[model samples]
Target chain A: MVKVTYVAHDGTRTELEGDPGDSVMSLAIANGLDGIVGECGGSMMCATCHCYVDDDWQAATGARMDGEEDMLESAVCEVTGRSRLSCQITLSEALDGLVVHLPEEQV
Target chain B: MSAGRVVIIGAGQGGLQAAMSLRQEGHSGPITLIGGEPGLPYQRPALSKAFLKTGEADKLALRPESFFATKDITLRTGEWVDAIDREAGVVRVGAEALPFDHLILATGTRNLRPAIPGIDRALDLRTLDDAAALRAALDRPRKVAVIGGGFIGLEFAAVAAGLGHEVSVAEAAPRLMARAVSPEMSRRFRELHEALGTALHLANGVTEVTETGLTLADGTEIAGDLVLLAAGVRPNTELAEAAGLEIANGIAVDAELRTRDPRIFALGDCAAFPEPGSGRRIRLESVQAATDHARAIARTIGTGTATPYAAVPWFWSDQSNLKLQIAGLADPTDDSVTLEDGAVLRFRDGRLTAVETINNAKIHMKARRLLAAAPVPTRDSLLQRNYDLTAA
Candidate 1:
């Protein structure tokens, strides 16, 4: 199990063990992390699963897939140098302790 | 003799909701819900996702078998509505005729089976049974060819590809979901599908749909074991047309969702109600629209005078982890601004046409309320609050 840390919009942080091969969004949703609606379920069709991958983990996380990158265009929070959709990022053994910053809303 | 009965044709999402609303609004008249498909009414949105995984048909039912009995709502499944006798105010189902005080056509839309060769081999995802059939086909490993890069096609493609099936989407349009989304959004989904190992072909038209493969307009045959038709949908307006009610792209209805005949009201995918925003009649196939239309129709039946159906249009699509949400309707001509946070807001001239959001439910919901509110939001109010449209 990979250690996943989610930083809430209000600065509260929660950490959970994310199953390998499962997406960060699914993990967040599974753990009942607020602000992540995951309305489209896990489909990239909606961008409600936005999260900024913590800077420390950006180097570990590779480039965003075209679908994931394109979907980030509609996210609410600034997808600055570290923005990424949690649904698009699947956890692996390589991503042991990944940190993702939660966005303000996931409609 | 007594109050007239309201017979709703096509017991889909909209039809079922209309029946419930009619009953909820305290309409004492008889309610008969008829459906062409067998089994209880079920939600179609999950037909592409959860149902595909579980293959549990029982869970898909919108209302249990006992729902009809408890609600005093007559449900006739496995029977096709043959015609609508406007004069008699009744719908003919084979040898039987169900009379109605008011006819509500909720026949919804059907998948457009394109004119192609080998069409018999392809499967559909419109109905619950169709999704079950496709789920069965998924048990084995094979290449799936999806026709029409619309929502269903792309959605199924995402699921199939995620499940490790090789998938391909052939779209005749220049971009995927071109009619529904902005160019930027289209490009995003296209890229996402590509990265997921699903092959996408745009600007390519299909001339023939074969069981083993598909023949493109350019005479290119794409090999496949199964061809799924996600080719969009056309409103089921044949019954209304035969009845001599006005038929535009869909069954034409005035502001009150009443067809030419004042006694007939329509909603959901079948009826083309005057667009709340554009005022140029449009038909939508979303749960929100169907539910809202049912509520609006209920208000009329309950009180007296009916108000126009004016509900903010919002949509959501799940594609392999990316949840795309749209708070408003944006046309091709609408101008789009990419905010600092990457949220794409569409504007028609000066007014906000729509808000395209991915993973940002706060903005999406806020935008919906803002658009639906009495006072339209200006650019400053939206931009001032750090691009938060919900900010007053």
Candidate 2:
């Protein structure tokens, strides 16, 4: 199992396990975490799954995908350099300790 | 309505979102989500788009079973709601009478069965079971005839074509997606499917659905092994209508999403509320509108504070490699102005209506923000800024 920690805007932390092929957004949604709406069901049609990778884990998680930046423009909160759509991030053994912070709102 | 027992009829996206949002808003009352479909509530958007290719049913689930159990949400699946007793404030489900302090009608829409002979021969693609059957039928290379040129039909056609099947789309309108998109966009998509070897029979309505395929209104017969009925959908307003609730295009609701009866609210594809800016009654069949309406309804019931549902309407369609996104609402007669970037700006009576883009998500997002702003950008104002949504 891959361990992922989701930090909400209010600083609440949630740790969950996911399969190697599962996405962070799907993990948050399946576990019913308050943050990360995943409104588009990881289709990247909606940016409700926007999240910020913990700075230390940025390099391990890699950069955004081809069309992720454009989709992020529709996110309800402020977009940051570390911002990435959680749906685009697939879990793996190397990134077992993936840590992501959720924005204040995702509508 | 604060902290009252909430009963939602329809466990689709909107219904599930209402239960979640109610809990998020700190509602402590018992929440019952009744769905006619068997199993946990899942999203319907991907049924025609991705599920046809992947067949990953687990991925479509909006929430896990554990989430419902932990949230104390009573999810009754495969249960048909018989009727709504407005005077009694209870809904009849078989022999049980489930009472509710507040009832949310999110019945959604159903596929429109046109009055064509042998229509039963054509398979539907609305539900997961329907998609599963269609996907199974596509296990072998088969000639496919899709009756409709709208989003669902085109999407299924694209997937079937990509899978090496002989596909043809017959649309009754002169142009594809005529009701939802502008002429230029319909042209672009026509060119796209044509390039993919999918024959498009525009302005041709299916006169009959035969075992071999479909016969068009123009007396042309398209031979195919598989026939898909994707003509369109009609709002599921029978229950609302039978209950004596006022219904226009759909179950009529106010700006606050409440039906004539204060304790009941209708929303999502099943309900038609006044358009935010124009006050024109309209019904949208998108996940955005459904979930957004659910949130607004939740706010009113969960917190005892009513707020008008004025979220900017947006939609997207994935056909082949192109992503057609529309930011706002546009009438069939809205004027279309194509920009150099290929994004079409729709206007009516000199006021900007909707922004349509193909494979351009940035401009689509910006257009949504612009449309949501007060004093909506005018066509002349947009022209001065070179049609750049960020400038306005």
DockQ of each: 0.05, 0.73
Over the true interface, candidate 2 deviates by an RMSD, in Å, of 1.4
Runs of candidate 1 exceeding 4 Å displacement: A1-107, B1-3, B380-386
Identify the CAPRI category of the predicted complex in candidate 2. medium
Task: For each of the candidates, give the backbone clash count.
Answer: 30, 0
TM-scores of chain B alone in all candidate structures, in the order given: 0.95, 0.99
What tens-digit string does per-residue lDDT give for candidate 2 at B1-392?
36799999999999999999999888999999999999999989899988999999988899989889888999999999999998888999999999999999999999999988999999999999999999999999999999999999999999999999999999999999999999998999999999999999999899999888999998999998999999999999999999999999899999999999999998799999999988989999999889999999999988898979999999999999998989999998999999887899999988888999988877887888888889888889988988778677
Model 2: lDDT of residue A14: 93
Q: Per-residue lDDT tens digits of candidate 1, residues B321-354?
A: 7777887788877777787665788877677878
Candidate 2, B-chain TM = 0.99
lDDT of each residue in A26-76, candidate 2, tens digit only: 988888887889998887888999999999999999989977998998788
What C-alpha lDDT, on a 0 to 100 scale, does residue B379 get in candidate 1?
Answer: 67
The CAPRI class of candidate 1 is incorrect
**How many pairs of residues collide in model 2?**
0
User: Who wins the TM-score comparison?
Assistant: 2
TM per model?
0.77, 0.98
